[model samples]
Target: MKLKLISSIFILLGYNSFAQNAKTDLSDSLVKDKQVILAKYVPMANGEYLYKGYQIPIDSFINRVNDFRADFNAQIAKDKLSDLSILKEKDVMFYSYNVLAHYQIYYGMDSVGMENFGKVVQEKRGEPNFYKLIDSAQKKAFPKRLSNDERKRLDDIIRKSTDLNDAALFKTSAAYRTWLNDYLKGVQRKKYLADTALGYGGDNVAMLKVIAAEISDPFIKEYLLYTFTGTVIKSVKNAGAKESAYKDFMAGTTNETYKKGIMEIYINYKNMSSNAVSPDFNYTDINGKLVSLKSLRGKYVYIDVWATWCGPCKAEIPFLTKIENDYHDKNIHFVSLSVDRMADKAKWISYVNDNKLQGIQLMADKDFSSDFVKKYNINSIPRFILIDPTGKIVSGDAKRPSDPALRKQFDSLLK
Candidate 1:
């Protein structure tokens, strides 16, 4: 938390050097000649604002972004910066708010377990009226030198861009959703909030609606809506509900890339969850003996889908080994499937031998794109899966060994 706050402060201060050494043009920086004009709606957080309320790290990020933009414009005036720099600055005007909205929802979610965030939501979780706040903030930050027409124009383009493109905005809005993955699966299983259903995006969407309404830019508005729409489509575990949400999002969206990507997430999960038949792999173990997922059908299988070179995968090994030791004599079978390249076979074996690795150490016939990996739509690792005695998937995307919940999952199955 302290690191985030300090980093945000630096983000505001670093631009000072950038503004003082402003260049004549940014044509070389950008390949295109055309400028993407946008509404510049910067949020402010005075010392009092922090002291009184909204003192969370997420709030600090938002405040820092607010201060950064203010300092940015001041520096532009100080150096009489170029149109290109000003355009670059303005194009990212809505970025901070977008980030703020993103993290605020993440922190507010029940699973994240941030108490201050929970308090913030409890105290102010009703209808959002961010426009009034923005209006008030802008009035205080206004310049006295500008003429009436100039002020009107500033208000128009800087706070309410006329050329807002929803499709274009969605292309770049992905960064905001990066922090969303961990909590999503938790939310889906009703493991977090009591009131929220499997696919509930209402908590985030309600706040987003207020933000979307407040944002004078059309693209920013649509972009927030997309967050709500895309989040629901991504969060739900029920196939039928997910399909419906996908169709709804696609029907309303115009961005083909965004549409295709969102649809693909849904498509990949289809027929790949609980009760689905586990994909079989005909591969050799580290001992040069052939083994397949089908051969271990009588006992429960705890499969770790990993690669030798993956740092995150290695990090989970200790905890994984502990689980194996704890349940050593049980009817459950533990296996580690390496999605390493065929060329790395020697290295994989060497590592297994060096570590004295427990469980079945098997390697994919090919690398990550092997048919078995592709069948489950595996992307990131180290992914874990649990399979029943009958070769049906218990959880295609099971909890990680590092997660405390993984033990509970194991107990629920074994006991």
Candidate 2:
């Protein structure tokens, strides 16, 4: 009796282990199958396989697409997940809907595509924005800026459209983020078209407030502030206006990341604002003597902030040389300040010597990190700046040597 009992216990334990292994095997198979389906069903020829002159009969194409969607949906049902712990299942559903929408639109089933898209926004777990996926299609459809009348027609169409709004979509859908980006761009473009000077610093501040008020969704609003703030700040030519816009946008958002970014930019703009005292620099000249901006006082200073590795900077060399020669006897001092790495100091010296570079050739002690460069927030090379006689900034972001505007400005200033 004891032997029989032991044998039965072992058999039961073995059976339970076998059942667990089988369940695991089935789960693994489901995940692999989901990946395969997502990979296999993407429409070809810009998702216009049915309509872009593929020569397929309309009815036949519709049947084939419907069958694929059914199979895809059936797989999604089998791979239904109870929680967000594993994203594979969620991805399966997302891609399934994505594929369905792609075909529906291309097969001239706009109403059906719109219906499925409606389901995507209301669905709780994953990202599902058809507009985000069909970016190329949208671009192809609207390749250039529309006239006011054309814009109104499209705007009316867009306004008439309706769907559920989900804030959580931003968390999961890269597509949702993309769609928001495009939408924000459209808003900015419309503002620009309405008044070409809308984003020039303080002008866009009210626009930002209006947008924030209009967009009740926090996630979407946060993203808009982040993107739109950067654009406003960069386009602001006036320091006072830039500061005001920065402070307003900063006050409006509690997002640490956005604030941090804007603060850095604000500091840069603040330091380089017109009429602000210019940042002082003491760098070694080509002849190895320290040349300070203070020493070259009582005259206008035109500083070309450049580097040896920059192609555009090199391209402007001839123009700069010509300007230097033309203004050789003028009150303005043309100073070419190179922000080359200290380790490449010899390379910079060699390039300047070989090229017979003109102007007061000087190099920073530390490439971009030098106090003056950092103060001016010089990131891209080939930047130009003009300082007044009293060590005040005339144009912290001046025109390039190649631009006729630069010469015109110089003529006006010198006169």
Candidate 3:
């Protein structure tokens, strides 16, 4: 009887070990599969997308992404992967949901994407101590009073929150960028109307704070602060409000990584402040002649950095033409600098010639890598800059040509 009991004990131990190994193996496999799918859909470093080694239209690529999503969803359902035990695994659940969330948001299924995001948050919301646990940890020293199981649970929650925060932040940012691309291309679809309506509206800082207050995941709130503050710093024209927004976020979060990111955004904003010496560039004009900021130093330079593919940039052409005509004899040079990719240079040349685009039509040799673009932090198109005759920036983020404020500012400058 003793010999038989010893053999059964060893067998039970081996079975438990095998079960643990299987769980780990499956988690790793799921994570790898998720990453491969994400990598396949992510845009190239240059912002151009490729599908299966070929450059296809955005619409076609989105369709391919939907097909992949269908297959992934079917697999998950067939495997009954929504069981709480498996779903609690950070790598398996968060990554799988992230893949689905990104495509849904990017392809105009806003409600469905948000529903999935809420489900992830709702999972932890069931624990009555969830908010208290995170708040205590963030505000005070680690809780040594909790039992081992409680401590382990807290650690698990934090790890899962981190994964969910990162994935949501990245997916939302990409979706916003995708919306901007669609808007610039003039592709208005009924499906993306929800995204269209969502913008950094007036008083976004206050709006974000209210939304942050309701967020169940404290880490998600902190990460969101970082994202919102960066956008405000870069895009918000009101210096006072943007500065206040940055300070508010910096004060609220203890996350060192997020703090560093916000600081970098502030530094970049300050680098492009008014009256700073503007970054110079040399590029070939449509006439094949070279032009440089230094060469145009004796006159005020109204530089319009634009791309041929941008519909909004093209919309301002008529107004820009009027301004060029109005200020033709003034001590100012209207420079329309094209940031179209070098691969699209021929198309840019054709557009400029066909449209009779006025002013000094120049194309950057290195496109976005041109020194001026990097230095000025030019991420969006139709960016207008006003540099004084001495090459110091009058307004690094100048008013758009269509804005009455631009003509008003010009009138003052000319006088």
Best by TM-score: 3
TM-score of 2: 0.47
Residue-level lDDT tens digits of model 3 in 344-366: 98999899999898899999887
Collision pairs in model 1: 40-158
Comparing 1 with 2 on TM-score, the higher-scoring candidate is 2
| Per-model CA lDDT versus the true structure | 0.54, 0.59, 0.57
**Poorest 10 consecutive residues by lDDT, candidate 3:** 16-25
Q: What ranges in model 2 sit over 4 Å off?
A: 1-194, 198-231, 238-244, 255-274, 284-290, 309-312, 340-347, 365-369, 377-381, 408-415
RMSD of 2: 20.6
Write candidate 1's Cα lDDT for 76-115 as tens digits.
Answer: 5554547545544543454433444333322312222233
Can you rank all candidates by lDDT, best first?
2, 3, 1
Ranking by TM-score: 3, 2, 1
174, model 3: CA deviation in Å?
6.7
TM-score for each model: 0.45, 0.47, 0.54
